[model samples]
Target: MSWTDGPFMGFDTETTGVNTATDRIVTAACVEWRNGQTRERTWLADPGIPIPKQAQDVHGISTEYAKENGRPLDEVVIEVAKVLETCAHAQVPVVIYNACFDLPLLNNHLVRLGQPTLGERVDFLPVIDPLVLDRALDRYRKGKRTLGALADFYQVRGEDNLHDALVDVRQTIAVLRAICTAYPQLGEMDLRQLQEYQRGQHRQWAEHFNQFLLSKGRSADVNEEWLV
Candidate 1:
């Protein structure tokens, strides 16, 4: 049996900006599911940088607010890393909506702060990306692809907002279930195999999206920073 036979965790984070190398984490959440039960943990950190108004507008985290109410960045990062490391050792897949962004952004924070980088060990563990799966399976689908949009498409309710970390994690789990239901063919595979399958699908989906952009005379920026 694969790791999917046991427990799993869903993770999400809201940051100060799009640059993984420079942006700071404002909020992060993780939801763990096992034996039909779910538990969630969230953290708000004082990023020690000015949260630009544009970024704050999206995630609703202000510099003043975080500095006054949030925990220290080092403390929050350590706690999150410890939990992630423990889960990784247990063979639990961390289901992130967008692994390319969150995973690297997290590692960057840890490395900059002289803390242990979760990516060093956690990279070997399984990671499931529902966003990639959604685009891969529905390559031709139109309109938005944000979490809220995907939630609406799958008829998964209770997730209209995007800022609150814990709420977003709960909604992410719901969206994952909806995706599994919508794409039954891919849902039957074990965790590791499923991850491998999605990577190929992601490549095809990226090409399709790029082609669509080209037809409109617009060039797609391939950099990950443009993802947000």
Candidate 2:
């Protein structure tokens, strides 16, 4: 069966802000799809800091709501980490949209909470990042490459609640499936080969983006790392 056939995990997080170093995960979701069925786990964490109005506007999770109904940040992080670690050990492909952002942010949270980072716990591999793949495959296609944009581009039906963790994960998986349908060769690749291909594609995209920034007299700050 193709990698897209079954047994993949879709992960997504709604956070306080864009800075992975300081932002906290307010909500996260993992949806494991196998044999045409899906099991989902979701978390709402009291991030222990004010959820800025700007961020709240995006995911609609306010600090007050989180504090009232959420688990402790440490508890949420531990549970999420366990799910990720289990996926790694099982070699299940984890489908993430912008993996570089989410993976590093989760690692930062683990370090902040005095827990072992994901890298120390397991070899997180076989990641399927539709963002990197879409850019690589459709280099010149313009407009936007946000999850919502790609969903629309790929004709993947998405819910109105685009920014919610669960909704985003579901849409991401749909978009990935649509991408595989368009690029049949991607369905033929082994998990490891697909992982390496995305890694290389991300690096090349980063380098090119950095050069564009430099040409515009801006700092070339994009990290070339795929999962950092």
Best by TM-score: 2
Best by lDDT: 2
| CA lDDT scores, all candidates in order | 0.79, 0.91
Alpha-carbon deviation at 1 in model 2, angstroms? 2.6
- Candidate 1's TM-score: 0.88
Tens digits of lDDT, candidate 2, 127-224: 89999999999998989999999999999966566999999999998898899889999988889889889989999999999999999999999999
Worst lDDT 10-window in candidate 2: 118-127
lDDT, candidate 1, 157-217, per-residue tens? 6925666777778787788877776667764687668767767777667676688788889
How many residue pairs clash in each candidate at the backbone level? 0, 0
Return the TM-score for each candidate structure. 0.88, 0.97
lDDT of 2 at 162: 92
Q: Residue 76 of candidate 2: its Cα lDDT?
A: 92
Q: What residue pairs clash in candidate 2, if any at all? A: none
